[model samples]
Target: MASYSIGDVADKCGINPVTLRAWQRRYGLLKPLRSEGGHRQFDEADIQRIEEIQRWIKSGISVSKVKAILDTNQGAVDKGWITQQEELITILRCVRPDDLRFKIVEYSQQFDAATLIDHVYIPVRQRLGFEQNTVRNICGLLDGALIEYVANQLILSRKRKGKPALLISWDDPDRTRLWLEAWRLSTQGWHIDLLAEPVELPRPEFFPGHHIFVWAGKLITSRQKEQLEYWHEQGYSIFHHNPDLTS
Candidate 1:
């Protein structure tokens, strides 16, 4: 039962101290004892638990969901039927091993990607703001899940049936922004070329349609706005979009 400081554990585990703090604060993942001076102190069991949690997370399980497995030291979880919105809120309120993702993929068998996004995801998203956490944390947690499950499905569906459009962001678009535009364009039967950051757009001739979209977010700089306007002036048919992530 030797003690290790937070910095020492982070160095040994190759995990950022800040990330560990986030996991603990958000998910109750760690139960470290505090020192007299209020520093976190970890023991050998804590180190081993951290490694185990890291392995499960690397395999795509969300932090909030890993607690029960760790507590029980069990491998099987009972599967039950829950509404997609409920499952999604579960992903936010209490993680359960990518179960939300599993449900979306499962539902896709019965519904097309567009239907799922419109009915399941969009409705769930609208209801997310009333939750107990700060909007930023709530958005951050759920957005990650959407990216893993919903966004990936939309991207793949986009590839299957359409002409590719040029999509770029002034910087990395918010998860909501990227997924929403991707869904909208994909529903319109267009493929996508997503650039997560500010970069030069592809030459117009190469894409033929020159149907470019700039997925701007709330934090656009004056220069980025000017760059988008310049693209508009060049007759490239560019559109700027910023998804309403707060809602």
Candidate 2:
């Protein structure tokens, strides 16, 4: 039997450590044993439970729904006859191995390259597991066509905007991704400039009144974390998506 610490499980599961801790504290999905020094140590079963929770969330189930199902040990919840567990399974089973790639190719045919990249390919990647290295690799292999198309769409979409929002992303992010994410924000009328890292962000200026910043990276360090706290204090709506699922 293997017992892993919180960091170990987070790395293996492709989830953020903060998110893992929140799941335990907030959702009761994991109950790890604490070491003498108070560090949490979890077993394989705990890891699996986190994965299941991730899967449920991906299917649009709220954390409350997941907690209720876990608490009751029910096969599935009523949810008006459409169970979260069932819906997640269906989506997982239906996603063919190369569905994303195929969809990208198909989208290229119907829409101009940029439109395909923004509306089609980007959304497909968003649905994928962020921590899965394969998600980036596969998307990378298809990058040339997708990037070109998406960049064009973003340029075109910029004409009709409010000011932009600032963005900071992980270095070497799935290249096609961070840009598209910025584009998504921009389309919602936000002007954006992706920073080197959240910590590198300059103090907010008011030329175009850029007031928000988003961090879309693999990890956040302590210093960047302080910056995030500061941003929150300044009344920004910051969001981090957890991409891990347990079953």
Candidate 3:
């Protein structure tokens, strides 16, 4: 049910914009819907095709061979592509963590916290790949239930001098992971702040001292490692988890 621009599709699929257009023009890999202004508009179908192409590329399959495969299996490819896209979008929209948690608590006789996480939270995150859309959904759910849970807890902690909640995020090529974490932490009662872009180890003064800084995927740059160390030194607790490591 979601329609995305070519840029949105490229960001989701982790492909360069120019390369995406090139594939369209030369390889006929994707035929996107055109806007009134002649802009390339893509939907779930185009996103799937790009993902398949990315898989082939990662596996060392030649672009030409990949194209031939798509050509020969056009019907099947289209069906599978659109199906996967629709499922992802659906899972992304539903299976929210906050709602699942409340349902668990409200129906404790029927469901438990662990059951909720396993059945609802975990699967949606896994499919959505932790992006901004997923994050927004998770946050909206948390804003109602989890935030209240944390506020109640905070009232009990009124006497303790707690550190300010810190939010640290690195600019990722694909922001799904970042978005998921932001919403997940917010659900846990942490204040949510974002760095719109990646930063150095010693972040700017605007970043709170007591916040939880999250890092994602492969730490491919020295700056990333430095940022991690800097936050650790600043007394902010780090919660680091790699999906690939667990999965």
Candidate 4:
């Protein structure tokens, strides 16, 4: 669903612009679509092929041969791992903090944050309906384990990456969402300043230093939404999970 320019492709593929152009002209290595201005335009598929070409080149394959391999359209496939949602729910219901943190760390490292949330955490939370008597206890224990292990891991990851940005959660900020955002940013190599609890808008002077500000929460008041828009209108490079604002 994304289109990329030659420069974007060059940066992401780690190929110089000159070399990428040469690959197109010399070996017909790319078949990008044309823009309205007749400039070369690439899609996500092109990016994937470019990554594959890079891998082959690193493995002692020649550039000339790279095109042919791509033409054949052979590539490695991703086999996604399955999660044990019910088992996790059972453990959380039993309030096993030690065992819970172990599973959280293992899965967080093995899979990305989004996958862990969607496949593991979200499913378990949904299944732990109001009818379940242990739901309250499970919720409390789960939150504690996540904050101690998983959230801290994301914090460390962001610290190591060092391209600082801010994450400010609004009223009653969802820690799970914060963890997911922090981990997502960490994976993309950003130094994150996560305000895990609800906080007022950071002072304007602080804005200059951050790459961007992400306002995250499940619910937002009109006042909160307006404040976010005010920051956005001020050219603060702000992003929010609120659908209405983005849309």
Winning model by lDDT: 4
Could you tell me which residue pairs clash in candidate 3? 130-176, 130-177, 131-176, 165-211, 166-210, 166-211, 166-212, 201-227
Which candidate comes out best when scored by TM-score? 4
In the range 1-247, model 2's lDDT, one tens digit per residue, is 8989888998998999999888888877778999899999899888877876776676455776778655544332332212322332233345443543445445446545334333345434443444365543454434544455456655776677577556655333455566655655565565555653333343543323455544444344567678668866776655332222200
lDDT of 2: 0.56
Per-residue CA lDDT of model 1 for 112-195, tens digit only, reads: 655455456654554554345664356566666666764575657665867767776545524564765676666566776666
Could you give me the TM-score of model 3 versus the true structure? 0.32
- Candidate 3's C-alpha runs over 4 A off are 1-164, 200-204, 218-223, 234-247
Better of 1 and 3 by lDDT: 1
Clashes of 3: 8
| Model 4: residues with Cα > 4 Å off, grouped in runs | 1-83, 129-132, 158-162, 200-207, 218-226, 241-247
Candidate 4 has what TM-score? Answer: 0.54
- What overall lDDT goes with each candidate model? 0.64, 0.56, 0.54, 0.65
lDDT for model 1 comes to 0.64
Q: Which runs of model 1 end up more than 4 angstroms from their true locations?
A: 1-83, 134-139, 158-161, 170-173, 198-210, 216-233, 240-247
Regions of model 2 farther than 4 Å from truth: 1-136, 170-174, 193-212, 217-225, 228-247
RMSD of each: 13.1, 10.8, 12.2, 16.0
Ranked by TM-score, top first: 4, 1, 2, 3
Cα misplacement distance, residue 68 of candidate 2 (Å): 11
Poorest 10 consecutive residues by lDDT, candidate 2: 238-247
Tens digits of per-residue lDDT for model 4 on 1-247? 7899999988887789898888889988888998999988999988877776776565345788777655443321123222366567778767788888788877776777656654566435544532356685477677667667655766577546467677666544456656555656665666676777766555545667466555544345677678768987887766665322332
| Candidate 3 structure quality by residue, lDDT tens digits, 1-247 | 6788878887787779999988889888888888899898888877877887876565345676678756644654354533433443453368655445554355334544333333344334433444556455554443345344434444544444544454445544334344444444444444555554544343445544444555544333566667667767766565443332322
